[model samples]
Each structure stands twice: as C-alpha cells, then as structure tokens.
Target chain A: MTCKECRKRFVEARYGELNAGQRAEFEAHLQGCAACAAEYRRLQQTLRIMDQREQPRLESDFGDAFWDKLAAKLDAEDAPPAPRPPQRETPARVLRMFDWPRASRIAAAAAVLVIGVLIGRYFFSRGGEEIPLAGSRETLLQPTALEVRAGDYLEKSKVLLLGLVNWEAETPEAVALDFPRYQRASRDLLQEAGYLKTALEDSRQRRLRALVADLEVVLLQIANLEAENDLSAIEMVKTGVDRRGILLKINLEEIRRAQSLPRPGQTSGKPSI
Target chain B: MKDEKELIERAQRGEMGAFRELVERYQKTVYFLALDLCGCRQDAEDISQEVFLKAYRFLPNFRGEARLSSWLYRITVNCFMDTRRKTQLQTLSLHNDAPGENHPPELSLPDPGADPSAPARSHELQQLIRRALGRLSPRERSVFVLRHYQELPLKEIGEMLEIAEGTVKALLFRAIKRLQKELAIYQAEV
Candidate 1:
C-alpha cells in the first residue's frame, strides 16, 4: 500500500473499524515502512496518555438530595391554593326577620304561603315521578341527576390521570406524538371542572368542593401542556398529577360502584328525587 | 439489559425509586464523560445532574430503539454543549488564559519525575492531555471525548451527534491530529 493509503488505514485501524484483510495489509505496510511505524507508535502513546486521566469522583452523596429537591419542586408547583372559609346562614339574621316594615312583612308572608302551597300541590300531583328543579336546595341535599353527572366527570378525570401516571413511551419520538389524546381529554375535563366549580359555589359539601378545586388545578395544568410534547411540559403535567395525589385521591371505580347501589326506598333504574 | 428496561418502564410510570436506580447506575459514567468534555470537576457535577434530569424528563419518549446508555450519552453531550455556551462569557473573563485554573485542587498534577512516582507521571500526562483537549474546537472535542474517552463506536458517535459515520471518522482524525500538534512539545520531552 502507498503511504497515503497506509495512513488512511491507520486512522481506521485506531478506531478498530478495519476488517481482518485491511488490518493484515496495514500491518504488512507498517513492517516495511519505518516512518509509518514510528507515527503509529506516537499515536498509540498519545491515546494511552489520554486514557490515564482519572474519572472525577463526586465528593458526597447527592442522588437522594437531588431527587428530594426535584420532588419538592414538583409538589410545590401542584399544591392547591388555601381554601376559603365556608359561608353559612347565622341565627342573628333570623331575628332580623321582624325588623322589616309591616307591608314588607305581609308581602314576605304571602310569598312563603304561596311557595308552601305550590310545593304541597306538586308532591301530591306528581304521585311518584319526582324531578327536582335545577339549583334547588332539595336537589343539593339529595342524590340528584346532576350529582350522577358530576360523578361521571370525576371518573373521566381519574382515568386520564391514571393513564398519565402510568404512561410508557415506545421510543423517545413517541413521547411527543402520544400526548394529543391526553391533551384533548384534559381540555374536555377542564370544561367540566369549570362548570362543576360554578355549580358547587353554593354547596356546603366542603370536602367535595375542595376535591373539585384540586382536580381543577391538575386538569388545567394538563390541558395547558404543550401539544408538541415538550419535556418541560410533560414534566409540569406529571408533577401536577403527582403533587395533587390525583391517582390516590380520586378513586373512580369506588365512586362508580358506590353510586350504582340503590338508595333507600328507591327501586332499580328509578331516578331518586 | 432486561433489568434496565424494567427500570426504564417503571420510571416512565412516575416511579421515582426506579428512576433513582437508573441515576445511580449511570452517574459515574455520566460524570466522567462530563469531566472529560468540560475539563472541570464542578462543571462536570452540574452537567451530570442536568443530564440525568433531562433523561428523566425525556425518558417517557425514549423508545428502546437506542440503548439507554446511548440516549444518556446523547443527553450528556447536549448538556455539556449547553453549559459551555451558557458559561462561555464568564469563563472567558475568569479562565481564558489559564488552561487549568478552575481545575480542582485535588486534580493538581505532581512534578513529573521529581520523585519517580508513577502516579506523578500519570498526573502530569493527564494534565497535558486535558490541555490538548481544551485547544480543540467544540465539535472536534466532542467527537474525541465520545470516541476516545467514552469508548463509543463511530456509528454510535455519529448517531449521538446526528452526523454521518464518514463525518465522524473525519472529525476523529482531525481531533487526533490536533492533539498531536498541540502536545508536540511534551511529546519531544518524553
């Protein structure tokens, strides 16, 4: 082989990319050529020197601390806002009922009498089909159709969170491609969560309100995640899911099963009033 | 390999414990790769942390098409490049002239042949190699670090850098030639 060919082969040989035939030819050239052999030795020595550099050692244990800090950041980002105090009617307001003008008092009494008669007539007239009016106090008190719908919304949210928490990527590229379904689901849930939030404003179910509020935050985070499947976006959504403990807190299966059981005095397939 | 795949699958599912295992398994290799690329211990540590965090963030999408180690090496390279770019202005003002100024005190080389200590000679040679590496362009430096230091094959290096295999070989050849040129004075003495 010519010197140029031998030198080219030398580079290939250094990388161990040369086949046996090429290696034999390169070795044959090296044996007869003093200059090429000397150059090869120098290259080997430089590589040996480079390899002698020590791998830097960390001074202390950092893995646990680092993971802890990351987890804390994630949790902090997902933590819900402080709950507001519950609004309630006080007895002091009841005593103020007599403070109104005589005409106002007469008008209030008449309104109440009319409402009572209407309620009595409705119960008597309906016989068995009891449909509570929307936004009624009785509807809030009993298990209404709206509550069943709310339960359904919660169930959907639970499935989304489970999918996110247990997500697996077949390839790195798959991560970005696979999140549109999640984004769409989150968007749908965000709309439902908002409606539920407004509906629950006058509700006294403090625990349910609080749960919905937390679920709203998680849904919002997921809904707003970048569609391109950005790593930071994914991390943000994952952190929100983990921070709110959504997977653990919202048990859809249990909620669905509980909601399915018959209420007292209610027949199967009959809507409770 | 199966164990690694299992750990990855678990980590993808938001299992911090499984991810931590992955971190511990690759920490040393990641640290050394960063050190070789950045030529400083503190930067290497920071870069190593960034690498694993990026890995975790991107792990969900990491289709087993490439080895986990290759994915990590790709991340390490990107992290190193990012860090170098971010710190370039500061590094210029602080350590432009002094090649080994930011090198940790523990990394200081002992006098060569002063005590006939093999370790001293090794340290001296390591310092020379680091200086030579510092003289190369970022592309050349990365190609050399991945190929020579990390012992990654040429095809893998090409994949990590998103360059052709022929380009990788060309870079490696250029890197070694540059190193030989830069370390000629030390070579003569030896």
Candidate 2:
C-alpha cells in the first residue's frame, strides 16, 4: 500500500476498523514508510489522550420529572380545541379551497360574463320576437326610441302642469280649474310613468330621466287630491312644479327631441303637422 | 429481538406504558449521544425530549424495517441540526456549559486521588480538543462525533446522515485533519 492510501485510512486503521487483509496491507506499508509510520503513531497518541479524558458527569437523567413534563405536553397536544359559538357557514371556507388570485380571477371573470351578457341582450337581443327586453340595438343605441318616448311623456306632463300652475285663486271655491278631469288623466299618466321609470333606469339621457321622475311625483300628488275645492293641495302641487321649473325644462326637451338626428328610413324628425 | 418486536407493536398500538418502557431502555444512550453532540447538559436534555416526542408522533409510520434505536438516532441528529439552524448561533464553550467551569462538559472533573499534574494535563488536553471541535463547522462536528464517540460504521453514518459513504470518509478526514492541527503541540509533547 502507498503512504497516501495508508494515511487516508488513518482513522479506520487507528480504530481497528480495517479487515484482516487491509490491516495486513496497512501494516506492511507502515513497516517500510517511516513518515507514514510516524504520522500513524501521532494519530494513535492523540486518540489515546482523548480516551484518557473522562466524560463530564451530569446528575440528571430521563427521570419521572422528565417523563411527566413530556407527558403533560403530549396531553395538551391531544386535547380538543375550545368550543366556539355556533355560526352559519361562510363562503370564506369555500374560498379557502382556491388560492386568492385564482379565486378573484374566477369571480371577476364570472361578473364580467354576466354583465357582458346583460349588456349584449340590452343592445343586440332581437332573438325572441314576442318578448323584446329592450328595443333593437339601433333604436336603443341611437337617440331615436328613448328620446321620442321621453318627448311624448314631457308634452302631456307639461300641459297638465301648465293648467294647474295657471289657477292662482284667492279663495277655495273661486277656483275654476277642472280638478276631477285632470286627476283622472294624471292617474293614467302616473301608471305609464312607473313603466317609463323602470325602462329609463339604464338610459343615457340623465336629464330626461330626472324630468320624468319629478313629473311622476307631481302627478302622484295631483291624482291623490281630495276634492275640486281643495285649493291648498292644488297650490302645493303647483308650487312644486314651479320650484322645479318643470314647464321650461319640458318645453326645451321637446324642442331638442324634435330637432335630434332622425332615425333610419325617416327623412325628418320634425312633426309633419 | 422478539421482546423488542412486541414492545414496538404495543407502542404502535398507543400503549403509553409500552412507549415509556421503550424510552426507559434507550433514554441514557440517547441522552449521552445528544450530550456528546451538543456538549451541553440542557441542550442534550432538550434534544432527547424532542426526539422522543417526534418518535411518538410518528410511531404509526414506523414500518419495523429498522431497529428503534437506529430510528431514534436519526431523529436525535436531525433535531440537533434543526436546533442549530433555528437558534441564534453562539460559539460553544465548555466553560460556560452547565457542568461548571472547573468541569468542562464531556471532560470529567480531576480525580482527587490521582497524580496531581496528570489531571491538569488531561484537563488542558481536553480543553484544547473541545476548542478545536468548536472551530469545525456543524457538519464536520456531527461527522466527527458520530464516528468517534458513537462508534458508527462509516457506511451506517453515511446512511443515517443521508450522504454517500465516500462523502462521509472525506468529511471525517477533514474533521480529523483539523483536530490534528489543533493538537500539533500535544503531538510534539508526546
């Protein structure tokens, strides 16, 4: 055996871990190589010194105290958690099944899809011929259908409010305004206003929506008037119409709707008469 | 062997008394092994406790493929390495260990009846050796202690440490070379 090989096996050699054949080879090398033999001797001496030093003594062992301490810790681990007040299960538990970004993406995608479908139906849906949710895309997207309907409602509301605001009688019986006939007409218009209010919810015409809502409130008050001589109630309705400038707004909107771009196949938006 | 097999079965079956008996059989061996690795009485105790706790928790997974002591030995080494990682590392000093300054851990107190200077020489040698051990990194220290103190075979040491046998030999040689350098003075004296 070479000196390098013998030195490499110094630990195994000193500890007597070598087999008989290897030990014989190692011994044969040591006999011939003085440097390797001296190094081997030094290793043996160092380990001898280590062997002579006694290990430090500790007074304790894994006694009853240690076992008891460990046992208590184990018991605590095994114990069930404290009870909580019963609560309805929340979606938070379901949400925990997915990571945050993935769950949020799923939710956002669903919301966008639902909204896209609704807006698509609101604009392009002419599939079901009988149950048309909104008008055709062109009628709704262009300013034709909504503006025309709003203009008609404004004209009727303007005539009714004008007749009421005109009668400023000093005494209740002196009023010559026809309250019964106007209230009957207003009740009918009030029902139509409810439908228009719902239809106009997603409409782009904010000004028209505001005017219709205000007119509905006034019409409702007028329809509920008690008698023909209830001048106080009529004055309240008239005051509201004046305060809101309902007449001027309706007149201006009617003129704009008349002048707005004409719908397809119609040469003029203006009234023929 | 049969009795050990039965004990392992009982312990696996959640018999607390059987588990304690198993602990009782190997407690000192594990404690001293930990004591040799860490060079502190308190850390040795903590490592021993953690080893058993882990062993109990994982008892159901034990497949009876190896001796229980071998399994516990692996856990003890892993726990030592883990404690080293998680705790703020400080240099290990035998002087500061709980064994007191006069008696450095892993080095016995000088016997009163012996030749006076022999104890001093032995103590000085032990101090130098432990200081040199402290200078080695954690992996070197573990390899040295397992081979030197635990008398583990080089192959078994490799298997237990999840390293190749050749790697174990390399680490062991590196550890011994460092020790030899630290003890050059003693080698000259001898």
What overall lDDT goes with each candidate model? Answer: 0.70, 0.72
Candidate 1 wrongly placed segments (more than 4 Å): A60-273, B89-120
Question: How would you encode candidate 1's per-residue C-alpha lDDT over A200-230 as one tens digit per residue?
Answer: 6776545566777898888787777755546
lDDT of 2: 0.72
Model 1: share of native contacts present?
A: 0.32
> Poorest 10 consecutive residues of model 1 chain B by lDDT?
B88-97
Instruction: Give DockQ per model, in order.
Output: 0.18, 0.17
lDDT per residue, candidate 2, A1-273, as tens digits?
A: 778898888878866789999999999999999999988887677666555544554446437767887788788878897797876667986666557765554554444444444433432363563122223233442345555555666666666666566544553323355556677667766775776676687877788888889899999999998887777888888789889888888888877775675767889746542
Q: Model 2's DockQ?
A: 0.17
**Residue A249 in candidate 2, Cα distance off native in Å:** 60
Model 1 chain A is weakest, by summed lDDT over 10 consecutive residues, at A168-177
